[model samples]
Target: PLKVFNSEQIRNIGVGGHSGSGKTSLMETMLFAMGETTRIGATEQGNTISDYNEDEIERQVSINTSILHGEWKHTKLNMIDTPGFSDFYGDVVSGMRAADFMMIVVSAADGVQVGTERVRQMADRYHLPRFYVINKLDRENVDFDKVYHELRERFGKKLAIAQFPAESGPNFTTVIDVIKQKAYKYAHDKSGKVTEEAIPGNLQSQVNKIRNELVETVAESDDTLLETYFEAGELTEAQLLDGFKSAINRQMIVPVVGVSATANVGVHSLMDFIVEYMPDPTRRPAIEQDGATRKPSDSDPLSALVFKTVSEAHVGELSLVKVFSGILKTGDEVYNPGSSKSERIGQIFLLNGKNKKNIDQLHAGDIGALVKLKSTHTGNTLCQKGKEFELPPIEFPEPLISVAVVAKAKGDEDKIGAGLHTLHEEDPTFLVRYDGELKQTIASGQGELHLD
Candidate 1:
């Protein structure tokens, strides 16, 4: 939100993992480490930026996908913090649609779980490039090496070690970055401040083994690099970076790193890795819908997807959109293919939780919001007024459970019906219908929690 950034300078990252893996906390830690916030908020404390909704505060779980942004190393990272509960998987699917890369967090204490596997499958369906983040390294009885191998066993041999904890549990304050061959020791004060130090002598052999494996994996990703590696016996650090990125982009290798989100340990280093290795929007394939392809570039015609809609207090309805091509500017009338009507674009803003920062325009590959647009809803495609094309709408899973609902008082049926309709628009997985035989309104979703 500081300045208009081009497509290359931006990263639309989606953060997701198993429930209680600290996905929400990891997001807050990154924001705090990057100076977006002064301190990290605990989910139990109910003050984190992403879980700002009322129900989330009471339940201490992320129920909605919140858009957050932070600046790191001169790059704008637009993060989507998604709900981890399976009942809310619809939001995760929608969040993945806007992301260029995925950070799937796994808790060292809990290891890989069902939610983790489910989200991984969703990312695979999108063919997204993702890396594993082993979080909660400071918890007792959590073994970094064991959890890492668990990842390798479950996800295959492509799991390359990017970082390993020097120590786990209570004394976990240091992590060795194998690529950089350096150690980052965070302050015990939970301030996210770190001091660079030399790698410990005790772990030198393990670090060397992992670094060699990483280099070999990178070199094998490209024929030229492989030939050079065989001739030179090794790839330079510069070559390692170049080939590592290519390997990741091609899904030839999936890097894994360790972190303690609660301690704010290694979060900063993870952000650095993302900015350096993850693929930018322009590097990925062009988005094609209905036989029309649109590259992620500023010069392409105006085309953006409305992924989510939030009915904000005192702000009317806000549409969250990710621009695939060209710039979405204020006052530009755009066409909504779903509604078959023209929407007059008005004020545009970048959102961090409930906080909205007024902005003039958003560049390609950037995610932002438009205020009070008529005839536009979630899953709608907005393009140049004369461009009659539509981006593919987000595909969500089917509802798994249904329950009947009745007005608490008579004559409140109209209000409840309107509210349920809006909820369906926001969450496509939540289905509602009137059961004529039962003479009742049946609302369906994934589970009991979803209905509650």
Candidate 2:
């Protein structure tokens, strides 16, 4: 029988990065490896989960955030793969809000780019724990040491490598797991599996230095560990693992893992790190306010934050949410503090791209969807009857591009307005306004492509 884990303790892994830096491709490989999808969706073909938008298909990029779920070795991984381009920054902002941990994707050859800096700033704003994955190490002319040094200089010393590339560029074959002191080799194919191997003979010294550094960092977490370290000179494996988890939960360390997501190299190891080191919802501290508090507990007064909204063909309207406290079940009556009214929890489902799995109750830490919630829009609050609590709303980027969209078909102006409103309902950043001076329906997004 397959074991089931509660949604309350599952990890919300957010994958964010620069466009063409392989964010979508990495998610595709992850889903494929976990048997979530029978085949991987390549960005070149425009079938990846995060790039499901029609325009994204033609442009071969992600236009909005896409949700995908998979089970990795008994841990449920609810991965939110977000668009990389600034044009769809709203999706990135919403993704960051819904996630408990972030995995920032950076290209090995490109080093640190503008998108990386932008996403990092967003992460900093929310005080979110982030893990950086240097992607595409299999490509040539990529200097691992130089890129690593530059990242440290640019991002700061708090950025440390948990896994280092054993060899880089075309000869990239394996990664030395800095914490484990083991090397993991990959299949020649992009979607292949990994094999455990001994640390490369030449890189053993470098690996030892990094491992010692990681151990020392972990040891600094507690007084007892610090004392033990001074007496013993080194921490045992079990002690190191415990200390690492504690350090990660406290945001004392941001671990770096290397991966060639296209070649499936280092992906599994990365997944292991996420499930093992990343903080789950239960571990996250509750947001406390004067009138309301949200802890990862079902017994607490029900309070869920609306982080995203989307318009679908047959579904009408969908509200994407993260339950910070209590349980939300179908037919449950909840208070929408944003609208100052009560709304019934219709159907709850786990969303994966366009596909959804109907579920009964969404626990804290889990990201799911509610169908046709009346009066509850994006950035709203839902709580138990008579208990009012409003979590902070997600901050979206300003629209930098605008265009006038007219109803091409005559006698459908009302329909066009309604359609645009529905679209805006799903995407908060999608602004639809009537330009009285110009007598046109003006829509604004982050860029020209975003308007389209």
TM-score of each: 0.98, 0.94
Mark the 10 consecutive residues where model 2 has the least summed lDDT.
1-10
Residue 329 accuracy (lDDT) in model 1: 93
User: What overall lDDT, based on C-alpha atoms, would model 2 receive against the true structure?
Assistant: 0.83
Q: Residue 349 of candidate 1: its Cα lDDT?
A: 91
Q: Provide the lDDT at 174 for model 1.
A: 97
Query: For model 2, how big is the CA root-mean-square deviation?
Result: 2.1
RMSD (Cα, Å) for all candidates, in order, is 1.2, 2.1
Q: In candidate 1, what residue range of length 10 has the lowest lDDT sum?
A: 385-394
Write down the lDDT of every candidate, Cα atoms only.
0.90, 0.83
- Candidate 1 is scored at a TM of 0.98
Off by over 4 Å in 1: none
